[model samples]
Target: MEISFVRIDDRLIHGQVATIWTKTSKCNRIMACSDEVAKDDLRKTLLLQVAPPEIKAYVLTIDKAIDAYKNPKYDSFKTLFLFTNPKDVVRMVKAGVPIKSVNVGGMCYKEGKIQITSAVSVSEEDIDAFKTLNEKGIELELRQVASENKVSLMSRLDSLKLI
Candidate 1:
């Protein structure tokens, strides 16, 4: 499956994720690759329930997400892989996950973060990590809804002199 987006949303999956991202991307699957959420059956079930029946959901650890996505089993469906935080995306990229860019959706406003002038807040670590990706030609965008403009985290990092 072609991954239309690699998003960093701490909520993992929810209403806007189901209706907005899925509809906008026209994806057939939603994969929540989170270590904590993957182990919690209840939360997994809850997240899965929010999605339409056609859009399959998988809650997985970073390793499992890398392994599963690399395999041929899910090659037929278009995917939108969701990571709970920027650290996970950094880890995935460090672990050789096949992601070119990361989209920041929602995460609490944290201290020392350049908010990137978007709905999400990013930390100094995120700025550094995103800068690493940007240097590697991976774009980091911030957006809550599909219609909104994608704010480049790279530029924000530059503004903070983090890049």
Candidate 2:
């Protein structure tokens, strides 16, 4: 599978993803990789249902996603990968998925997390995962929509003294 785009959005397959990012990436498939979601039949079905008719969708566990990504049968698939958190991204990357960059789309507000951008909030664990991705040469970009200018997430973290 050719991963055309990788985004970390807490709300997996929402409006912005269904419209903007999908068109921007020109991906034919939307793969939401999360162990939690994959285990929930209702959520998995809901996510798959929301995808545009022209595009194929799959909600797979991290291990399954990694296997599919490495499998030759999926070589023709142009996929846009979505994860709920940076920790999952790190897991895939560490498992040897060749992700060159990742979009930090929306992390949302959580009890202990600090707002990094209007759309992103991160806790210490998220910060460490992002730092790990950065160290591995993965470019972390921050943008809520396709039309917006991409911001370097690491730079912002540095400027904010969060890392």
Candidate 3:
């Protein structure tokens, strides 16, 4: 239960994340929750190598990550839970990931997707998950970086108001 920061970024791991977030949050381990990446050991190795030696990188299936958090081994180390999309976030939420707040680090606005902020975008189904998490008292912050202003994802849910 030491994961303090959860971020949704489609790019997975990049230079800024391997450096900035690790330094900023003092996170020693990164648990990347993605079904696609979990099966790919080569990609996982690349991600692990990018971490600046002091940090540990773990690429896990969504289910494994949820299970891993419940293990007492994770209780000692502060981790950062990283996901590539809101769908994974929603799954983790439903599976009991024990996260309080989620920050929208990046979501590439695809065709027909509604962009709430430069950093936040939602498909119709994603909007529903956003509402679910919002109602459950999970704080959602729309920001591309730590310097960006915070915004509510609901405002972009096609005229949905303060539900």
Candidate 4:
């Protein structure tokens, strides 16, 4: 499977992802890898339902996603992988997935999490996971939309002295 794009988006699949990023990725498939979402039948169905016309979509657990990636049957698939957190991205990478870079997007603010941007927030765990990904040489870019300029996530954290 060719991972056309990998994005860490807490929303998983939404208007911006279904419309903009999918188009920008030029992928024929969109796979959301999250254990939480995969176990929720309603959310999985809803996410797949919102997929762009002519594009296939699936919500799978990280393990399943990794297995699918290693499967030769999906060799022709050009996929956009979406995750809700950086830890999951790190998990996939550690599982032998050749994820060269990751687009950090739409991590909503929650209590105990520092707001990094209007659309992004991070907790101590998130900061560590992001640092790990960066240490492993994965490009972490922050962009909420396709038309916006890409900002280095690590740099933003450094500038704020959060890391």
Best by lDDT: 2
Candidate 1 has a TM-score of 0.88
Query: Judged by lDDT against the true structure, how good is candidate 2?
Result: 0.95
48-154 per-residue lDDT for model 1 (tens digits): 88887778888989898878777887789788989878777877777776688788888777776556554677776766676677777788887877888878876
Model 3: what TM-score?
0.87
Rank by lDDT, descending?
Answer: 2, 4, 1, 3
TM-score, every prediction: 0.88, 0.98, 0.87, 0.98
Across 94-162, the per-residue lDDT of candidate 4 in tens digits comes to 999999989988899889999989899999999999999999999999998989999999999999999
Give lDDT per model, in order. 0.80, 0.95, 0.79, 0.94
Task: Give the distance in Å from residue 87's predicted Cα in candidate 2 to where it truly belongs.
Answer: 0.6
TM-score of 2: 0.98
Candidate 3 structure quality by residue, lDDT tens digits, 1-163: 6876888888777787887877877887888889998888898888777877888788999999988888887787788888988778888888877789888788888987777666656677777777778888988777666665777665545454423
Task: Name the candidate, 2 or 4, with the larger lDDT value.
Answer: 2
How many clashes (backbone N, Cα, C below 3 Å) per candidate?
Answer: 0, 0, 0, 0
